[model samples]
Target chain A: MRLMSKPHSARELTGLLKAPTGIVGFDDVTLGGLPAGRPTLICGAAGCGKTLFGITFLVNGATLCDEPGVFMTFEERPEDLEANFRSLGYDLNGLAAAGKLIVDHVRVERSEIEEAGEYDLEGLFVRLGFAVDRIGAKRVVLDTIESLFAGFTDQAILRAELRRLFGWLKERGLTAVITGERGEGQLTRHGLEEYVSDCVILLDNRVEDQIATRRLRVVKYRGSSHGTNEFPFLIDEDGISVLPITAPRRNLAVCNEIVSSGIPGLDAMIRNGGFYRGSTILVSGVSGTGKTTMASHFVNAACLRGERCTFFSFEESAEEICRNARSVGLDLHAHVAAGLLRFEWARPSLYGLEMHLARMQRDIETFKPAVVVIDAISAFRGPAGDVQSILLRTVDLLKSSGITAMFTSLRSGASRDEGTDHGLSSIMDSWIKLVDVEENGERNRILYLIKSRGTSHSNQLREFRMTDRGIELIDAYIGPEGVLTGTARITQEARDRAAADQRERESNRRQRQFARRREAVRRQIEELEAALQAEEDEEAMLLGEDELRDATLKSDQAARAIRRRAAE
Target chain B: MTSDAERLDEGAQEAGEDAGHYYLRLYVAGHTTKSTLALNNLKRVCETHLAGRYEIEVIDLRENPQLAAGDQILAIPTLVRRLPQPLKRIIGDLSNTEKVLVGLDIRPKVACP
Candidate 1:
């Protein structure tokens, strides 16, 4: 963020002024832009965009910097150049008509000319000076000055004339761009780099594995400190935009707002009820593990919340994705028609990884979506390291823009490793890994919250199923046999129910037997008491008969017996 | 088509039409030594070969700098053959007479003289 905020102010401190190139990310890479009022040599091989680079500089200078420019071509004609750069949206005719540019073609044919004696390039100087004065141009571009070598046969005279040309350009205080053809070992075939001593940039178009990537590097910037690394650049319909490798480190703004992940079951896993707004989430899994399903759910949820979403799909077309989402009860088509969701689909082999990233970045910038979903980043063809670095930059862009981004990576193997195949799990704020568990003659999808940086998340392996309704996260069976899903979980649950039933039945039988024994003991005690009472009664009767025999002699004994009976 | 020597023979060259007449334009920056030498060499060559049939026009670019873009000039002391079916240019001071004649397509007819 603090790189080059005010270039004018920076000039005061560094004593070197810069002219902004107006190319995206290019100014930052150069700490501002090319040194102002000086010549910069841009060297590259054939068809490597040397002319385009020079044209972009001139066009941008004319339209953006309020500075008129002179484009002197040593090869192609003005009409051919105009037609070639028309696709890039540069109106050469209009600019020239507006007096903001001048196109001068320096045609030199060797077959029609003979050098009989000494001659200087005074004619070239006069023409260039006239054009520059006509437009009061501040910038000048000599597209591939190396063509002079093919046109002229005198090396000594040509070299001396070139040196004088550069000196003349500098004396006029014009910021110049002189493109050169790359030599075998030197920066330029004629070593023009030795003459232009202010700045030197190299453009390279390299093809590896049949995929071409364009890169730009600032080899030397005299009296200025600039980024020294080779940066990936793209030339599309909008013109050139360079992607600097270094991501915004600590300057990204932190957000506390949370958005749901669509599935309540999954949202419940996160401590904040969902992912942080503007945080990068990676959903990695093997084939048929519902990576796209999870990403779609997020998109659906974002759209439902009245937030715009951009879904970038590398594997499936928009129609196919909408159809699949319909089966899962997510009407992505409705959101799309509502203008809340946009789907961009491109094949993985369409372009280089950096190009894809640049295009996606451009789309995001234009759409200004609150949420973005990249379905299957693994489909991008490149080395793991390159893909990871590109993803790192992508994530940085999203985070710095405060846009919630979700990227799905297709893991080739169902390994237990929590990292993505490209090793992007580290830079992600949240990483959810999905794997299919095969047990009980069936395979079931399970999700594991591998890493969540800013929020607490469930570490359990959540069993999820994609039914016709949607993806539902069910409680995985956690037992001594480890986490089980699908039929294994169902069978374990049934076995647990039967064990509970048998334990209840055995307790009921034991209680009944104990009650029967207690009832028998009570009845035996009652019988023994009855026998004792009978024996007491018989003894009392015998005493009463002996008393009656005595009652014949005395009536008082009967009265005494009656009184005794009354007392008892 | 009038050279310095042909101007002397203008009365005799007046009968000749525009065709079969050599028209040469020499482009020079200033009155430099090389431009002077190229101009003198051309006059000598015309007198020796076509004489009254050749015409030479000397243009000094130092006065009218913008005129340099007319013929797409990059070198000083450049001689352009304007007449005949095909046009040709010879850069540098015309010190080499044979090469200048070949460049101007004045060789085959030089044998007649």
Candidate 2:
């Protein structure tokens, strides 16, 4: 009957009334939050952030939701709890002073306490009721209520009392969070799960390969659809934040506008002149392959356009990156000074991949950058599956926010395949593979445009050179010897030039020899014509003398004929 | 037994007036059966061992539940010995006399060599 009852608000569609926890990415995973006005059990081992989770929930409820909450810590003193939460910037004392929160430390010291006869925990109920009623609290947190087991010897009485207490809390219509220590095989050491069955969240901190990652999972949410995946959460100075990688889907606003890739040559390789405005570009290469330099160029171009950019560097410090960028003729420090560029650097080993993503997401949210550059995603070295999954989520977050992102991955060895070691090339809108072309006993960098979605790009590998001026993408020489780079290309080009010069010189010599012979033949023909003219003149003279008289030739012929006829 | 108790009281009084005096506070939720039993047992023990040398302060949490926080009370029928240098707390109805005497440090002082 209870299961059949509709516990949701009348205005909302069929489901329980949810309470938004105001934690980053937590609400999306829980479909909203824990079941409202109901008890949710949070079980975890020691040092797994069970207490912090409860405190954060209560604090968020009081501060953000405007709902007063009561935090009854069974293990920590009120002052100690306040001191611990202060590191997260949570002013518990201030909230308590404002009457928005009530922290009641239920100290049960077994050493000083002696059990003489039968008893019940009515005093606890009275104190809790008083605190709750004083602040009109809508949320209650019983942190590690299992500590009561250490104080009481009568397990039966404690169980009965706890069941009654849960019922009383439910009747009061208060949202409650009960934390318990992890058991050997059960959800909680004392089986608190049997009492608070409406919702259950499990917090875990696991260390693998010497890297610890905190994860939160909603094991069950009665009457609600929730994300069953183990969401990675981070507890930093700001507080606990869960990364709901599965919630942000691929349906993001696609922009047609393109942004330059900083290097003019690199931009020219893409058909659109640049990458799409909100696209994810993966630049994979081995060590010292000019990946970071290319990313610097991109960030510089974005900053030059007066657009904000965030550069997350996991391998190097901001100063080191800025200094390195300066070597490539990019003044990133100036952009940083101009407030157009922000460099965030952290060691990948300091946190798990998901934490880095969550921090990056938060940075993007606060800075509202138009472009983001992750200098080397490979610095987050771990299982390929985890690295790729986090990268996919990071890309999704950037795409959903309509921010252009460039991720540089470090490929191991000389693998020239299109696939990145992290297997993140598929989700990328554009993938640029950088490799070392070892030729002529020297290594040179070459960049290939592996794929660019929705845009045509040059498939040819360009000799990626980090010139003093900037990056230069020269068209690689595709000779019979395959692709040539470095000094090998230069030597081949010089040899071709010398051979062309020799061919031109031979043709010039042949042309000169032919012109000289033709001139000699023309002179000979002219001399012969002169001689023939002289001979003809002489003949004419002789004829004219013989027939004077024969009246100068042809006239002489007519005159001769007339004379002949007269003589006959 | 009366003479021995008087001599022990004189020796405790010589040290300080508060030394021989017992300040006991019982925290309970109204006049429940366990609360009453605990109160009666505590009074009987005090009268027999520390008659006229003890003071009992009964705190009915139902009348003023806010007072429970001061003593860090959680269980019903709780007795707190406030006057001793190191305070002690005994929970549950004070029906077990031997355990109560040991918990309140009354039997050890009487049995001292």
TM-score of chain B of each: 0.78, 0.80
Kindly report the root-mean-square deviation of model 2 from the true structure over all alpha carbons.
7.5
lDDT of 2 by residue, B1-113 (tens): 33643564555556674556787889999888999999999999999998887989999999898888878899998998875535789999999998899898887866788
Give the chain A TM-score for each candidate.
0.77, 0.80
Candidates' lDDT values, in order?
Answer: 0.86, 0.87
lDDT of 1 by residue, A1-568 (tens): 1122245335554688888888888898989998888889999988788899889899999999999999999999999999998988999999999999999999989898888888999999988998999899999999878888998999999999998898888789899999999998999998998788778999998888787878899998876888998887888888888877555666766889999999999999988899989888999888889999899999999999999999999999999999998899999999999999999998878778877887788788789999999998888877878888887778888888899999999877736666555777778888898888876789999898887788788888899988778889998999997787898898888998899889989988898888988988988888888998899999999999998878775887777899999999
Please state the error at residue A314 of candidate 1 in Å. 3.4
TM-score of each: 0.78, 0.82
Model 2 per-residue lDDT tens digits across residues A1-568: 2332344433234757887888888898987888888888998888999888888898899888999999998889988988999999999999999999999988888899999999999999999999999999999999888999998889999999999898888889899999998898999998998888788999898888888889888988877888998988888887888877656756776799999999999889999999999999999888889888899999999999999999999888899888988887888989999999998888999887777887898888879999999978878878878888887788778888999999998877756565554777888889988889775689998888988999998989999788788999899888787778888888888887898899999999999999999999999999999999999999999987897754566786788899999999
Q: Looking at candidate 1, what is the lDDT of residue A549?
A: 78
Worst 10 residues of 2 chain A by lDDT: A1-10
Model 1 reaches what TM-score against the true structure? 0.78
